[model samples]
Target: MGSIHHLIGDLPHRSLHDLSRRYGPVMLLKFGQVPFIIVSSPEAAKDIMKTHDSIFAMRPQSEIMKIITKRGQGLVFAPYDDQWRQLRKICIRELLCAKRVQSFCAIREEEAARLVKSISSDQAHLVNLSKKLADYATDAAIRIITGTRFENQE
Candidate 1:
């Protein structure tokens, strides 16, 4: 609880901004028992993420994350190790490559058109634009992954 007392009431971002203004862009803080390095500035964030990334590459694993990821089997939760490196390489080469992403352009366009049609079709009622956009995103992702449209989007 080193700096938790100073962060009460006000929004966390605002508190952090004030603290950073006084303490500098990068500061170490303790919440309960965990030590967190708060990086507020883009330059500091870039330095930490790009230059010193290896030092911070291993994420703090939680019980829930362990259960959800089957003991860090996936890239997102896995420790920075051989397995994580392999998974990252595979993701870059397969799922996130330029060619693979370009291949999904048609699906994205189709989904956008469908979303527009859906929104315009029910002009009589007030549209829940947020829900519709979320559905559109889900539909597009499903189409990209399964090569088929999601049914019952309503």
Candidate 2:
């Protein structure tokens, strides 16, 4: 039952787009027991996100998320409640404030420069850009967290 049949063979986004064209900017579709309100237009999205954010702020709970987040304890998966608000405030003040982020700018820039230099140095061969970028990210995160760079991946 539901609109799951409409999405049988096509990609979800393509199917949604086709349905939106037929239905209009805002359409409701049900996938099994869950009902989803699909907003295809920018205006509708702004209305939902900006004008009515609190009404739609809560995310659906899942067994996997509960296990990963220790029963919705962290900021990312926690319910929209007092604990989540306090966690958000503390994170903003202590970790993600403008000054705190700016303090790590030098480390990020240095890592980026190192990544570019590494790529340039290996111009003769097929450089694995994905792995290099992942390494750069790990190095930068480690440096920022511990204030020391790893020596030979130690």
Candidate 3:
């Protein structure tokens, strides 16, 4: 009986998709200790995004995210106030501007060169190309974001 209750209490994740199809687009799910509200349709998606943008803009203050981001600086966890607006403006006008965007081209070229070198260095066996490519992508993004190559650092 306890096992049955536990199983039943689990969130509908992929399994719940079918049940939501039978019932409706929006549904509540509880997977053990976590809770989730699933939105499964295009119309439901637009309604939440457009009509209730500000209503759902706030994030649930999670402890892990707090430790990682130092409790949300700009857009992600900001209260949509003046400071958030100013930071957003700077990101759009300065950080993401045309000149700043061009700075990433060099980083991309370097990361790509490293990836190609890795692939060519050992091609005698059945290599897991997928894993290699994933590593390449992660390294490329990290390098671009932080201006530091993570591959050589660790």
Candidate 4:
């Protein structure tokens, strides 16, 4: 069993970097008995992501993710297999086709304009571009996915 509570209490990214510095690039961590391999170095990440893509293509689904994603039915969280391949093909052929993507150009441009307007309006002090960009991206994605803008978002 791993100290998940402790991990949650600490700054996860910073803690991971500290661990990676103490250990090597590839460090095996146990999160509540589930082993997680952390690859810190770019060369190691490239090896896994590019060279042996098929071997580690599937994402590790947590219990909460499984529940939220309805047993991993969507393309983003689905397991690597024939079913996943078929789902990916459908997404590429239908949802992500050139015409379909082009249809959302207006939406993207509108969101960009909104972001620029918000930034320009907040010219009194140092504007937090990171937070603004995050909000913009979230709103844009929600609108694109649900066909409705997020209401009362600050």
- Per-candidate Cα lDDT values, in order, are 0.91, 0.90, 0.76, 0.87
Query: Of models 2 and 4, which has the larger TM-score?
Result: 4
Q: What does the lDDT read for residue 9 in candidate 3? A: 48
* Cα deviation of 145, candidate 2, in Å: 2.9
Q: What is the TM-score of each candidate against the true structure?
A: 0.71, 0.71, 0.69, 0.72
Residue-level lDDT of model 1, residues 2-87, one tens digit each, is 77987898597889889999999999999898898999999999999999999898888888988998999998989999999999
TM-score, cand. 3 vs. native: 0.69
By lDDT, is 2 or 3 better?
2
Clashes of 2: 0
CA lDDT of 87 in candidate 2? 96
Error of 3 at 61 (Å): 1.1
RMSD of 4: 4.3
Clashes of each: 0, 0, 1, 0
Query: Considering TM-score, where higher is better, how would the candidates rank from best to worst?
Result: 4, 1, 2, 3
Off by over 4 Å in 4: 1-27, 31-34, 40-45
Candidate 1: pairs in clash: none
lDDT score, residue 95, model 2?
98
lDDT of 2 by residue, 1-154 (tens): 8988988884878988899899998998888989999899999999889999988888988788888889999899889989999999999999998999999999999999999998999889999889998899999999999999975452
Q: Report the poorest 10 consecutive residues by lDDT, candidate 4.
A: 1-10
